[model samples]
Target: MPYSEPNSATLTPTAIFGGMFNPPHFGHLHPLQDALNLLSLNKLALMPCHIPPHKVTPEVSTEHRLAMLALLCAEDRRFCIEDIEIRSNKTSYTVETLKQLKKRTQSPLWLFMGTDSFNSLRSWHQWQSLIQLCNIFVLKRGREALLHFPEISEYMDCSAKKPLNEAQLLSLHTQTGKVVALETKLLNVSSTQIRNEIRTRNESEAKISEALLPESVLNYIHKHHLYES
Candidate 1:
């Protein structure tokens, strides 16, 4: 079924950044901060899924992951934690989540995603429904042009021309079913790497003071003894 949002006189520009967030770190935060600044968005939701469809099971428990995200929310006023997917306790499908958001609010929805995920979007369950429900912002890390994966070019706003101006890019939010590329610097880090580092590190020096992770999140991890196995 095609999901359509009701017309509203007032709308808020909101974006959603969803992931396992097994442990939210700087890699997730940097790109999000850039999006918040570039869009001047009112609110950006940080959603953590209970069971990510594409990735392996998370190393930490759902409670631990949400606690870590809460720690982050405490530090930044612009970000908030959305736990619907966690509460579902089922496969986290993007389309279903966006539908729920539309039902909750009339905000113009923008879904932020990395190039790798965008490229493989066709594999997702009900992938086509995703764009119809909300706009997609592909956060490109490098200077290379956005990947023109098969069947995806139709969704890109090719008429707008390359290197879109500020106003042109912002206009995308006014409508749905368009995929636009946004250039931003993303930290070259991954949750898997962080987990490995913690698992292999010397037991006595288990404290990870690395700048890739926030101090509050680190404290929470150490307190819960997460990823030590």
Candidate 2:
């Protein structure tokens, strides 16, 4: 499933948040909204992996995940659901995905990830080539401790502080091969926990807070009997 190329002439700086949003939830959306605001990104693309390399394959089908993500994106004009990886029907590697996106638009591409994923950066295939393709943004929750990886640390550029101004972000976007850490108030929620809750608890006992999961997503999960044995 090839992605339709965007018009490069009218393109603006865009941020890509790729994940196995097995079931899209607030945890993924809130911090991304923060990134869009802090970095002054004109648009944010939510790229759901077809097959994640770092974790177990998602239990939910790709079609269902795409549908749930579509529901989430429909609420915001700036959000876009990029199905490039799902369409590929292969392992979704960030480096490869970014390379494809780069070919489609000249706009600066910003790759978003959590600090936990950043810590395991060396494990990714062709991790070294990622920074060359797009600026990497690491989002940290509260005062969470950062992992010590001197190899990655040497390339870190902390000059762009939080509440980044438009000028600073513009400067950062032009240059690649730098990692910037941004503080975000991310929710302490996990998809693993959500799946477990759904499987073990009855409907009344497994009441999912609307704050954590969107109503549309919750409804879809029940309608499809996902995460239930």
Best by TM-score: 2
What C-alpha lDDT values do all the predictions have? 0.74, 0.75
Q: TM-score, each model?
A: 0.84, 0.86
Expressed as tens digits, the lDDT of each residue in 19-106 for candidate 2 is: 8888888888887777776766658889999888878888778889899999888767789988889889778999999889888878
Instruction: Tell me the lDDT of model 1 at 58.
Output: 84
Candidate 1's residue-wise lDDT over 1-229, tens digit each?
Answer: 2233454214675688898887888888877776666565657889898878878988678888888898877767889988889889678999999989878877778898888888788888998777777778777776545656443323443221244555654455456767766667757888877787777877443454366688889878777888889
User: Native-vs-model 1 lDDT?
Assistant: 0.74
Q: What is the C-alpha RMSD of each candidate to the true structure, in Å?
A: 4.0, 5.0
Candidate 1 positional error at 21, Å:
0.6
Q: On a 0 to 100 scale, what is the lDDT of residue 4 in model 1? A: 39
